[model samples]
Every structure is written in C-alpha cells, then in structure tokens.
Target: MSDSVEQQLSLFRYLIQTRSFGDSTLRFLDSLLVSKDVKSLVEIRSSLNQLLKSESLSIIQSITAESVHNKLIVLDFFVCAFAIVGDLESCLALRYEALVVRELKSATIQLLHVSPLEWLNFVEDAVKNGFHAVAVKACENALRCIGNSDVQKLGRDVISDNLKANTISEITRLRNFSLASITSRSVQVQATEYLERKTREQQKLDLPYKEKRCLASTSFRNGIKRQNMRKLYKRQTLLRANSEMQGQHPNLS
Candidate 1:
C-alpha cells in the first residue's frame, strides 16, 4: 500500500483502539482536529443521501433533533454524516474548528476516529440493527465518564446498554407511528368509498320520486281554447232559439 494509505490506516486504527477520552484526552483530540483531512463533518447529508433510497426504519428510527442533543455520538455522527453528504453549511467545520480552540462543553464530545473500514462496520451495524441512536448515546456517555483504565472498560459497557435502550425505544415509537398511519389511511379510504357509494344509492332512490312537473304554457293554452269553444257553441245555440221564437211570433204581431 502507498505510504499515505498506510499512514491513514494507522491513524484510523489508533482512533478505534483508543477508549473514550476524558478531559485531558479530549483536549488532545481537540488539537488533532485542526488538520484538514479529518474535518469534512458537514458532507454527511449528501454522501449518505443516495444511500438512503430505502429505509427499513426498523434499522433507523426518526428522532427529534432535540433527542440527539449534547451527546458524543450526536457530535461525531454529525461530523461523519456531514463529511459524507457534502458541507452545504460551514457549521460542521466551524463547530469542529471551534472545539479545537474552546474546550468542548463540559460534556465529552466522543471522537471515534476509526479507519474507513471500521467506520463502515460501525455505521452499517447501526443501520442494520437499528441501534444508531444507542451507539451514539453510548459513545457520548463513554466519553463523558471515561476516566482511568479501570473506568474505561466499565464505562463502555454502561454506555452500550444505555445506547441500546435508547435505540429500542426510538424504534418502537416509529413502528407504532407506521402502524397508526396505516390504520388511519385505511380508515380514511374506506370512509371515502362508503360515502361515495351512499351518495350514489341516495341518488338512485331519489330517481323514483318525482317533484310536481309544472305544465308548459302550450298545454295550458290548449285547455283555455277548449273551454272558449264550448262557451261559443252555447251562445250560438241561444241566439238560434231566440230567432226561431221571434219568427214563430210574427203572425201574432
């Protein structure tokens, strides 16, 4: 392998093998982050965007931005995520650089500078096992509490359990939401179909019932003509009878 690859591999290996750092150890990493190669923290979204064609969601649950706050995994994951995606916002780089000058908030920002291979394994596990949140929180807690050699091992265990719990909880919530949405959508569809069917049924039922259809002016006019024809016949009959009586009375006159 080329010398640069070998060197990067060595650095990656060192980062993984090292335990979560305490105050002094973190301070050292803060210094190391000044270098350019490691600080592509903001490109995570773009790099991973295409990789997210399908989400099992069982593997990674939706989380509020607040749920991820002040955690070591949150910070480092942001770094990795931004690095992969592309740094649209300079915030990741600024944050990474700022910590180099200012001591990270009292909370230990866990820096697990693993090799590309190891980083892949860790991230893949999170995606596959639905434990990213757990992993993140575990690392955060590990960094915050890890002290001497004796504490580091113990801290890792504790952090791992905490991360697992968090991951399980988040996954459960998502599963519930998905199930609820399915139910809601199904209900809405059924209701709409039923309403449409009922509307059609009502229209069919109403078809048999007729409102009073008003007569057209032509029909009304015909009725008036028939009545006028009868009246004219009666008037002509009266005139004929009167004329016959007057003629019969002429000899008497």
Candidate 2:
C-alpha cells in the first residue's frame, strides 16, 4: 500500500471519530456532494432525503435506547470511516438549523420513551464522552422535545444513548491508532487510487477552452470548436485534491 493512500484514509477516519458528520452536519454533506459532484450529486442527496420523511420519536428511539435491530448507514461503511469527517464549527451551526426545521416540521404531539431521568443520565454521560457541540445539543433537544409516549419517548432516549455509545466506542477503538497505525484504511485508500489510475480515460471534448470553462461555470453547452482548454483539467482536478490525497503515495514494500 502507498503512504499517500494511507494518509487520506487516516484523515477521513479521524474526522468521523470526531463526529464531524453530526446530525446537522450531515445536511451540509448532503449539500456538498450535491454541489461538488455537480454532474450527479443526486445519489448522496437521495440518501439524506430519505431520513427526513418526518421523524417519529418512537421510531428513532428503537435504534438507540433499547435492544433492537439497527439499520446500517452505509453497508460495509468502514467502521473507521467515523473519524472526524468535517469542519466541526460549521457542523455545529448546521445542527442548530436542523433543530429549527424539526420544530417547524414535527407533529405537535410528539413523545419519546426515554424518561426525564434517563435524559439527565444520558446528557451527563454524553458530555463526559466528549460529543461534538452539535451532537450534544441534538441529543439534548431530542430528549426534551419528545415527551409522554412510550414509543416516542423510548425512541428519543435510544437515539441519545446511541449517540453516546457510538462516540465512546469510536474514541476507544482509535485512541492509539494514529495516521501511522491505520493500516487497513490506508490499504483501501491506495486500492481506490490504483483503481482510478487504471480506469483513467483519455477523451476529446470537441470544444474550445474558454467555452468549456464558460459551460462549467454557467451551463453545459452543446456544439463547440475543437480547441485546447485555456488550461488543462488535470490542473483543475489537482487544485481541489488535498495535499494528503495528491500525487502517488510511494509504494511501500
């Protein structure tokens, strides 16, 4: 595996562990993929869209506060992928916004299974466990807002508990595993790099340089004269690639 590949994977895991993808932050991720993967952000957008079909307090709690089956957010999602995965400050703000939206959208008579007693214990445990700012508030609100119904109450409690448990687990598992120690993740990162390199395509756009940039910035154009880009896309693609993800990770025997 290449060292460069290992670094990128390590960075990704570090972010997830940090709760960079908190409830509110997930919204921005949805937006980012939609924005960055311009030609097709719909895949990610769809995943988030499915979550907000109107959250039932009880339904959510089942996954958390009680013993029950849980759905995988991403199948084969590397257990390590939960590292600090985003800009923490920004995610905090997004979580606040999500709260406002929920208040507006949720049904008036909401209930959760977690009791007020449990909420107190959960909050204390979460704080000690070092949840991200947004995650802390989310669990707090989910606990407070959901009231009176065994199912809804249970669901909300579970959600909060789940958040706490997940944070603790990830932190413990990776506590000593630094970028230097994440071998499995690094190997996968290198594999992805090799796959992309092998699948590289050489194609002609049949258009002019300025026109291509204009299309990219403004709208996709149809017909155009064959001319070299004002600059090549390799430079453009490379510009966004992080230094960690850039270039070939030296092959290590």
Candidate 3:
C-alpha cells in the first residue's frame, strides 16, 4: 500500500482501538472505499465485525454508562460502518438504539443533523414500537435542541399525548421509591451506629463497678479463712492444756 493508505489504515486502527468515530475516521474509511477496490471495503467490514464481536465492544458499551458523548461516538462508528455498505435501514436502527441510551438522542440530532419533524416522527415510531421510555427521553432531548417555541410545544404535546401513561407513572414511582429507600437506609444506619455507641459507653461505665465487686468478694473470702484458722488454733491449745492438767492431778486421784 502507498504511504497515504498506510497512514489512513493506521488512523483507522487507532480509532478502532479507542472505540471512537469522527469525521476524519469516516473520511478515511470512505477514501479507502473510493480509491481502492471493493476488496478493501470488504476487509474494512471484516475488521469492524471482528471488533464488534469481541468482548471489548460490550465493555465499551457498558463503559459508555451515562456519558452521551461516548455513546454518540460508538453510535457514529456503527453508522459509519452501515453507511459504508449503503445499508440505510441499519444506520437508522443504530439511531433508534441511541434513543434508549442516555443523552444519545440529543447527540443523534446534533451529529446526524436530523430535522425536528424527522426526529419527532422517530420518537413516535419508538413509542409505537413499545419503547415508551425511549420515546419520552427523545422528546425531552429534542426540546432542548429545538430553539423554536412551536417545535418545543409540539414535542411536549407528543410526549403528553402519545407516550404511555402507565410507563411514565411506573418510572416516576420507581424513581421516588429508590430515593425513599436510600433515605430510609441512611437513617437506619445512623440509628444502629448510635445504639452501638451507647452500648459501648454503658459497658465502659459498668467496668469499674464490676471490678470493685469482684475485689470486695475476694477480700471477704480471705477474711473468713483467716477467722476459721484462728478458731482451729484456739481449740488445739485448749485440748493440750486439758491433757497436761490431767497428768498433774493423777496423784490426787
């Protein structure tokens, strides 16, 4: 391959490793398709498929987490791949996937330059497909991007009219329930910690009393043993004195 092709391939390799796609990456891929034969495109697709099939892609997806920007970059790579094969349906599907992921709706509209009505219809389709939460999120995102008050009102109406009532209610209830549970757990933890501290304090306070009682009992037992020894010694002495008196008085008897 030529030096330029080598550089492009290097850039492609770097982008794939980072799980990122940008305009430069797209241009590089497109250049490969246009300058080289169809085999180059096939090789590119094979490489992408290999990457996508690996555990790394799943890890990248998971790491995207709540980051809309990272999510958008991943979506862009998928879109670039689908666009390379001229698979419009697949490209649109990636956008739908982006809808459910956080902040990606706004990313999609910004990057794809999707018109207000097109995105509105996309959101509608998502609702019709039973992705109520996705639809609601997309509508909410569109409101921020769409500067026109008319379009904003239209989006608000779509969310109010077309989205499922139970889905929204359930989401709200779950969010509130989660907050309440967290608060309850925090309070319980504090109460348990306080009780444990009081118990430790009580044990500390009672320690000296317990020691004093033990020492007093030990002294009383020692005193009783000493008194018993004295009584035993006096009885032995009296017995000896009686024996001596009997010996001296034998003559008188």
Candidate 4:
C-alpha cells in the first residue's frame, strides 16, 4: 500500500483504540475517511450527532467522569476530522456539542475539569472560523470554569500559582477579544438590517421622484459611511487586542 493509505489506516486504528465509539459510529468515520465525499461526511455527522445525544442521555442517567471524558475525546476527534475535511458547519456544530457536554459534565459531576488552555484553543479556533457566537460562548464557559473554586484548587494542585495566574490572565484576555468580535459582528448585522429597512422605506415613500432619489442617495451614503466607520473601528479594536495578547503570551503564535 501507498504511504498515504498506510497513514490513513494507522490513523483509523488509532482513533478506534482511543475513542469510545460504537461499531456503527466507527464504520461511519471509516466511510468518511475513505470516501472523503459529501455523502460520507453527512453520514458521519449524523452518526456522531446521534452518539452525542445518546451520550448526553447516558450522562444524565449516570454522570461518570470517565464517560464524560471519553465523550469529550470523541468529540474533539470528530471536530478535528471535520475541520481537516473543511466542513466548517459540521465542525462548528460538533464543537458546540462538545461545549454543551463539558458544561453538563461540569454541572453534574463537577469532577472532569477542562483546562483554560483547552478553552482558549477552542475560542481561538471558533474566532478564526468566524464563529463569533461560539467563541463568545466558549469564553463565557472558560470564565465560569476559572471562577469555580474547585477548579481553582485543582489547578493549584497540578501547577504552580504563577502558572495558574498566567493562564487565568490569558483566558481573560481571550475572553475580551471574543466579546469584542461578537459585538462587532452584532453591529454589522444590525447595520445591514437598518440599511435594508431604509431601502424598503425609500421604495414605499410617496415623494416626488427627484426627492425620493435624493433621499435614497443620502441615506445610502450615510449608511455606507456608518458601516465603514464601524469596520474601521472593529479593525482597530481587534488589532489592539491582538497586539496585547501577543505581548502578554509571547509563546503563542
């Protein structure tokens, strides 16, 4: 077999060994990797969605830390695979599901704790893919996790106080960045809706043709100006935030 095929087989076996997936789910993933087509992707997504639902129910029935951790690992693998195949929508959906699972686990068992760096990575990935809402939710979850006294005690036991402080500081910075991104996106959406409303109003107005034209032109110009200003401000805000993050987290690329 070719090296590429060998590598694929190796990865498939590794996934099977590591993830606690059922036979059907494994088959779906195998099909996805082998075909790398839309149909296969859809099949895998459907199978994984069902698995997530079942796992969620299982968690409710009995909240075992091992089971929750296994589910999270499977989800991480699914998200990474979907991303590799360039299925942003599926990846995002799976990522959100993983977040939900984490939240549920945190709420129920309160034993399986997700680290700040893991949350940071998820937020970064969400932001990079323009999933601002997901990124913001992730930031919120991360902040909540950090605020938990149990999680703080666990972190203190595992790492030095200085390291934990740095991690918390970085998570805060990323949370602010994610909030800004969502806010900018929200503004853009509102601006688009406002422009659309203005256009509809202009169309329905009972003014003279010249007056209508002038009114529409002015409205369009003003809307464009406002949008441009918002865009410029967003750029500046993001740049400033990124600069600060880089300066603070020199190890992050």
User: What C-alpha lDDT do the candidate models reach, one value each?
Assistant: 0.42, 0.40, 0.59, 0.66
The RMSD (Cα, Å) of candidate 2 is 29.0
Best by lDDT: 4
Model 4: per-residue lDDT, tens digit, 47-126?
A: 54554444434443453445866777667766665555456756776777777687667656645566666677777777
Model 1: per-residue lDDT, tens digit, 58-156?
112333233323234434533443343443233233233323222233234334322122223333343344444433433333333232112122223
Alpha carbon deviation, residue 43, candidate 2 (Å)? 29
Considering every candidate listed, which one attains the maximal TM-score?
A: 4
Q: Could you give the C-alpha RMSD of every candidate to the true structure, in order shown?
A: 18.5, 29.0, 14.8, 27.9
- Model 1 per-residue lDDT at 78: 38
Query: For candidate 3, lDDT tens digit of each residue in 1-253?
Result: 4576667666766776765566776676666656446676676555544544453346446765556667666876776666674555455567756554533353445334444555566655554554455555556555543433222233334423224343334334433444455567779999999999999999999999999999999999999999999999999999898888888998743
Model 2 ranges with Cα > 4 A deviation: 1-85, 108-136, 148-253
Model 3 lowest lDDT segment of ten: 147-156
What lDDT does candidate 4 reach at residue 57?
A: 48
Clashes of 3: 0
Model 4 bad stretches (over 4 Å): 1-81, 96-111, 150-157, 206-253
Model 3: CA > 4 A from native = 1-168, 251-253
Instruction: Supply the global lDDT for candidate 3.
Output: 0.59
Question: What lDDT does model 1 reach?
Answer: 0.42
